[model samples]
Target: MDEQLKEQLVLEATRMLDKAYVPYSKFPVGAALLTKNGQVYGGCNIENASYGLSNCAERTAVFKAVSDGNTSFDYLVVTGNTDHPISPCGACRQVLAEFCDADMPVLLTNRKGNIKETTVAGLLPGAFQSGDMV
Candidate 1:
């Protein structure tokens, strides 16, 4: 994806993050994915009383595409209001790395306009694939 597209995703992520339901952590996060079809999907963090059940923004966006029968992400934008854009959790990283290719780009941005671009390899180096279990 081009820088322009990446910027758009970042903006969308920032907007979505403002709507996050995070009364406990008070840390709102948003994620936006750019599909191969040039479509964008975004999701905000939804926290639950059970921390284990809390869903991260990354998984929410990815799962939305997957549930709609779409795979292959060209790029993703994740953002928060912190000093740095929040990275996905271990579970979200594993799940995304499973579905993403090595070159899949994940853009992390903050309200300060700082951005960091990381690849699937960078985020989850040598991640375990389902085939490893079989």
Candidate 2:
């Protein structure tokens, strides 16, 4: 993605931080997924008492986009309240690998304005795909 669009996506993810429903860990995370057709969907992490039922911001955004018929994505931006950029968790990486292209760009950002650029393949090398199972 272009620098301007990446900035815009980061801002959208940052804005979503306030919408997170974090009570246990108190760590708010936001994610923005940009579709191949120029659509952006933002999501915030929602914490649950059971913890296992809680969804990550990245998954939430992906789920929302998929639900709206936007499975193909170009870029994804994630933001958190830390000094350094925060990458997605293992589960989020697997979920992303399921829907995103191997070379899809993923941008990680922090409240301190730090940003890191990485790709889905970089995040999850040798990822298992549907074809592998078949």
Candidate 3:
């Protein structure tokens, strides 16, 4: 992705933080996914009273893109208020692996201007896929 697009994605993700429903953890997170088709999907972490039912920002963005018939992704930007760039949880990493290519760019960012650039496979090596079940 170009520098401009990357900056836009980060801004979008940061904007999504306002929409997070994080009553329990008080930790809001946001994600912006860029599809190969040039569509961007923004999502925020949502929490329910049943903690197990909460959803991560990364998964939300991927799910929204998938629902819109845009599964092929090029970039993903996630932002949170943290000391360092926020890393996606294990489940979110697996979900990203399910839809994005192994080398897809994932930009982890924080409100402190920290950024960690990595890839889908780098986030979760040996990720379990459909083939793993066979």
Candidate 4:
């Protein structure tokens, strides 16, 4: 993506931080997913009483896009209030690999504007895919 588009996506994710429902960890995260059709989906982390049920921002954005009948994505940006770029958990990586192409771009960012650009395959090396099951 171009610098301007990346900046826009980063801002979108930053804006989603306000919508997060983080009561337990108090760590809010935001994600902006760009579909191939030029649709953008924003998501915020939501915490539940049962920590295990809590949803991460990355997954939330992916689910929203999938629900909207958008499975093909071009880019994803995730932001959080951390020292460095926020890294998605193992579960989130798996979920992303399920819907996104192995080479799909994923941008991790922090509140301080630090960004780490990686790909779905880079985030989860040797990820399990449908081909692996067959």
- What TM-score, computed on C-alpha atoms, does each candidate reach? 0.95, 0.97, 0.98, 0.97
Candidate number achieving the greatest lDDT relative to the actual structure: 3
Candidate 3 accuracy as lDDT:
0.96
lDDT of 3 by residue, 1-134 (tens): 79999999999999999999999999999999999989999999999999999999999999998888888999999999999999999999999999999999999999989999999999999999999887
lDDT of 2 at 65: 97
Name the runs in model 4 displaced over 4 angstroms: none
Give each model's clash number: 0, 0, 0, 0
Please, what are the lDDT tens digits per residue for candidate 2 over residues 107-133? Answer: 999989998899999999999899897
lDDT to native, each model: 0.87, 0.94, 0.96, 0.95
User: How far in Å is the alpha carbon of 110 misplaced in model 3?
Assistant: 0.2
Preferred candidate (lDDT higher): 1 or 2: 2
Instruction: List RMSD in Å for every model shown.
Output: 1.1, 0.8, 0.6, 0.7
10 residues in a row with least lDDT, candidate 2: 1-10
Residues 13-126, model 1: lDDT tens digits: 988888899999999999998889988999899999998898999888999999998998788889998887577888988988888887798888888988888898889898
What is the alpha-carbon lDDT of model 2 when measured against the actual structure? 0.94
Residue 19, model 3, lDDT: 98
**Can you tell me which runs of candidate 1 are displaced by over 4 Å?**
none
Clashing pairs in 3: none
